[model samples]
Target: MNLKGIHHVSAITANAQKNYDFYTSVMGMRLVKKTVNQDSPSMYHLFYADAQGSPGTDFTFFEIPGAGHTYPGNQSISTTSLRVKDDAALHFWKDRFTEHHVDHDPIVELIGKATLSFRDPEGQRLMLISDEYNQGVEPGIPWSQRTIPAEFGIIGLGPVFLTVADITSTKKVLTEILSFKEISEVDHFKLFETGKGGSGAQVALIEDSEAKRERPGRGSVHHVAFRVADETELEFWKNRIEDSGMPNSGIVDRYYFKSLYFREPNHILFELATDGPGFTADEEFDELGKNLALPPFLEKDRTHIEAQLKPLQSSKE
Candidate 1:
């Protein structure tokens, strides 16, 4: 099965409004979509990406609305890395950071690449890698039209390492249910790859004996969304996961897409998301990210929701 790429990466955040500001104003990503968490409607579920909310380009936030924080550890968890186009864009991002008064560490080398590490308003650890080695032609359109030259854009997603208390169960699930092949194992880390390219082949899980289960709060990964071909492919995954006796929440409408959610042995949330009816579903190419869009269920309540929402800061350059 050929997986397309990452549909999106969802993370928990402390404050909805502050994250909204940091992602849009500081990071220069457009707030392509904003809506309340369907399960927890009191808090906002904000999405930041290139103008049109394209897959792989997206980093979403599920606001915790004044919750306590989550600490980082090596229990199948690590920093979230966003791949930038090249080193020059790293300079551009540096300048932008200085101009906007956003703080970031000086560029450093990590796993043989130049990376800039930083935190969002809620302190989620994020790193941007300025390397696109062996990247292919861009297929999906950019959600944001902010002129991300091919060399400086986020071409690939870095491997997400997990920390599981026991690697045996999760390992079985990955190999049998998810079809991941065990690549190699090192100290406190086990790597698995799909032998595919783009975003599909880039997921890794790590197990640590001393790892403790941590709750998802601000600054922690809410979920890692994997790609599926379409509804048919989604059904295949659903059946596979169910057959494996892993608890799974079937399909749920996510407005722009559909998804199924489950938790691995490490307790990190995983989402199986589709790749269709993208940003163009609600907005036109020319008008992407120009305004807030509400799903059909929330359209009637738009006025009330809009009234409760604070004004957005302008990011026009």
Candidate 2:
């Protein structure tokens, strides 16, 4: 089975309104869905993506106000890179971040590509990588209400960087179980790609055995999901992972998609998710993220869920 690419990256946020404004206004992404965390319905789980909420386009956050800061090191996904069109688009983003007073690093080259690194309000590490070779291949669906021009919009996810203690066992899990092929190595990072090796197909493993282990809290990544074609593929992977002695959460119906979650050798949570029954399953394409939608099982407790979540103000507000 071929694991297509990154399905989504889920991180933590301290303030829902601030996260909403930064992603929708400054970053030029579409807030595709608004829902509560399935396991804990009290917290808000927000989804941001391209217009259609495509598989690789999603970047989500869970609001946890008092959750302490993330200690970045081994066994954690430290950065989520978004793919932009080219170097010119990177320049545009750099200017935009400066104008908005966003905390960011100067543009740097990694793996022979121009990258603009930045952080959200909650200190979640993020980057914009200019895919010069694959320019315009995965263009973002622009939101008409976006402040930034459509041409410079963030297209989709790029390489997700995982800070690992070592690459030996992780490499086996990636290549043998997850279908990733080692593409290259730069500095201390070993790069792996799933499909044809472009944007949305990469995962970089940075080895630092002495680094401190990350504590999951605000500004930390909760999990990273990889895409499968359908339910059959998802089940196949679940069986394979189980047979290989890895612990998994089994198949879960997530309303929008079917998910099977497991921890890799480094203890980073990995999910195998399907591509069908997208964001439009519950809400219309035009009205997505406008209402707080919940799964059928949680519908009875909507009042309690809504009461626990703070009112999220969109950029337009």
Candidate 3:
């Protein structure tokens, strides 16, 4: 079955508070959820996204303190690209960056579009492009404290690259199981497409022999999720991942979506997520990103969980 699209991308960060400020304040995304990392409750799992926390709109990060710095290699590949409304919007961002004194370079042409590149507080590379064909998405509340205008907020995440030592296994899973098609290969980099012509999903697999293993910490991407149509297709993917001898986490409800996780040889976490029971599941449209939201499974532990959390708020610096 063809996957629907991307779900959300998760990453690891050093300081939860700093990450929160950058994603919400600087980027203008809504802090859809303020919950602890399920595996490590001490750290947070901060989710940043557009209105309704739509799939492909989310960029999540976890705070794991004291994690050593990873050597950025050609294989340490992770890029968070965003789709914009038009080239005029790109000009708007250029002026916004200049007005806010944010460090950035002039727009660069790639994939036949003018794009601007910058980095987040955690050093994750970010790019923005005004591609009119992307899905129409509503923006969340205008973060009044943002350095940039809310009208030009990021719509959704785009092609995220993965630096892997070997692309064979991961490539197999992506093509054979996930139904991704190889679009092109340039300079030893393989690009795969998983969505429709324009608004679909894309990934670049860069093979690097000396690429160091990613140590989950600040600035590290947590995982990239592939979208499934519904629960039925999610089950199909479960059997497919298992049939291929890749160990996977069985279907787990994530409130906004259900997810299954696995790791490729290079150790980048990969998630197969279903899109449904969206951001509105636990929040009102007008009041999203205003409070903490707990998954149904974690609702009973809210009091205990809140106590364990380091008081944090998504704010602009």
Best by lDDT: 2
lDDT head-to-head 2 vs 3, winner: 2
What does candidate 3's lDDT look like per residue over 1-317, in tens digits?
67766677887788888788767766667787777677666667888887557777788887878766644654344666776666777888888777766667898766545778876766776788666544423322333434555566677776777777778877887898788888788656687777663433877787777756655446667678877878898899899888888898899887678889987666777888887877788888777766767777777888888887778853745
Error of 2 at 14 (Å): 1.4
Best by TM-score: 2
For 228-311, candidate 2 gives per-residue lDDT tens digits of: 989999999999998899988999999899999998888999998999888888888889999999988999998888898888
| Better by TM-score, candidate 3 or 1 | 3
lDDT of 1 by residue, 71-90 (tens): 66645356676766667767
Flag regions of model 1 displaced more than 4 Å.
74-77, 91-103, 136-156, 184-189, 198-201
Model 2 poorest ten-residue lDDT run: 135-144
RMSD of each candidate relative to the true structure? 3.2, 1.5, 3.0
- Taking all chains together, the TM-score of candidate 1 against the true structure is 0.84
Question: What are the clashing pairs of model 2?
Answer: none
Tell me the lDDT of model 3 at 284. 85
lDDT of each: 0.67, 0.86, 0.72
Error of 1 at 201 (Å): 4.1
